[model samples]
Target: MTKEIWLNLPVKDVEASKAFFTAIGFTPKPDQSAPGERACFQAGKSIIMLFPDATLKQFNGGLGVNDTSTTSQMMISFDAETKEEIDELADKVKKAGGNVFSEPSEVQGWMYGFAFADLDGHRWNGLYMDFSKMK
Candidate 1:
């Protein structure tokens, strides 16, 4: 059985990426990170690992990594506790130099959230779902 999962992402700068995530409320794991080579952060119960492009290429069998700025292979979504939390994160993302591509708004009358592209152009969606409104 899988007890733990880690999301590995490629970044241009490990320290910069670490700073960006930290600014947006992600808890950095210094003990698990290698300075200038890799960074680890805790996002809720998931572990997010950021590695430089060269390092990630080696991990992915030397395949070319997609240019997230132009093409997206996937979008990671996070569940927020409330609409206010989504809004707060959106603001923090903007302040941290991330692009808020999607403004906070209602979705399907039950979920509210916004999307943003991190410093590495990785797209992330923060959503708050109202279970009470579910059919």
Candidate 2:
């Protein structure tokens, strides 16, 4: 079984990223954060690591940094256990100063969800999956 997971993302400003996530209900994991360069947040059992772009570049080898404004290679999604939870989270995203690209609605019949872009323009989605409706 997979024990744990970590999603690492590059941010222009670590402090701002931390504030954004915190405002949107993500809890900061101080033990996991690396002082000024990295900010860590908890997303369920996963750890979300927000590192300064330059610091992230050092670990990227040659893949290069992602230009989230021009292109999106990743979209972080949060799983919701209830439809209401999805709606609540969607609202929180906007309240935290994030942009909602897709408002809460039925998606593919089985998913009740919404999509938003964080302060760093990182795309994220919150969805409630109805397993019985999936075909």
Candidate 3:
């Protein structure tokens, strides 16, 4: 009965993180109840919810989140319609104050992408895959 999925992430600053995502073209989902404490964005068919560090810890039952600076938690991938889109996103991420860990490059002659870390160090990558190049 699962109709949709949402990703809840911990952020050091909701406002800054929201701005970063917005700069990279993620559509914001307005929620007046939480104000500066939370932010939500629509990434394709999924929803990404960002909460202040302490707020997310409370929601996680005090388990806390990873220290992204030293830990590799996960890589969230975004599908691009073309290779140019991937390149464009990488540039946007860098301009938005994100760390572009991996420069845009071809992968196996079929996929092209680049990885970046958000201001809070959450890893993400935008990829464009050409199925026709696959055997």
Alpha-carbon local distance difference test for all models: 0.94, 0.89, 0.90
Best by TM-score: 1
Considering TM-score, which of the candidate structures 1 and 2 is the better prediction for this target? 1
Candidate 2 lDDT, 1-135, residue by residue in tens: 888798989898888888889988899999878767899998999989998888888888856787888999889888988999888888888888899999999999999999999988999998999999999
Q: List the residue pairs that clash in candidate 3.
A: none
- Error (Å) of candidate 3 at residue 118 is 0.3
Candidate 3: worst-modelled 10 consecutive residues by lDDT = 29-38
Summarize candidate 1's per-residue lDDT along 1-135 as a digit string, tens digits. 877689999999999999999999999999999989999999988999999999999999989888986799999998999889999999999999999999999999899989999999999999999989876
TM-score of each: 0.97, 0.92, 0.95
Q: Runs in model 1 with CA error above 4 Å?
A: none
1-135, model 3: which lDDT tens digit per residue? 776678999988899899999999999988622667889988999999999888888988899799999997899988999889898999999999999999999988899999999999999988999999976
Give the clash count for each candidate.
Answer: 0, 0, 0
Instruction: Judge candidate 3 at residue 78 and give its lDDT.
Output: 80
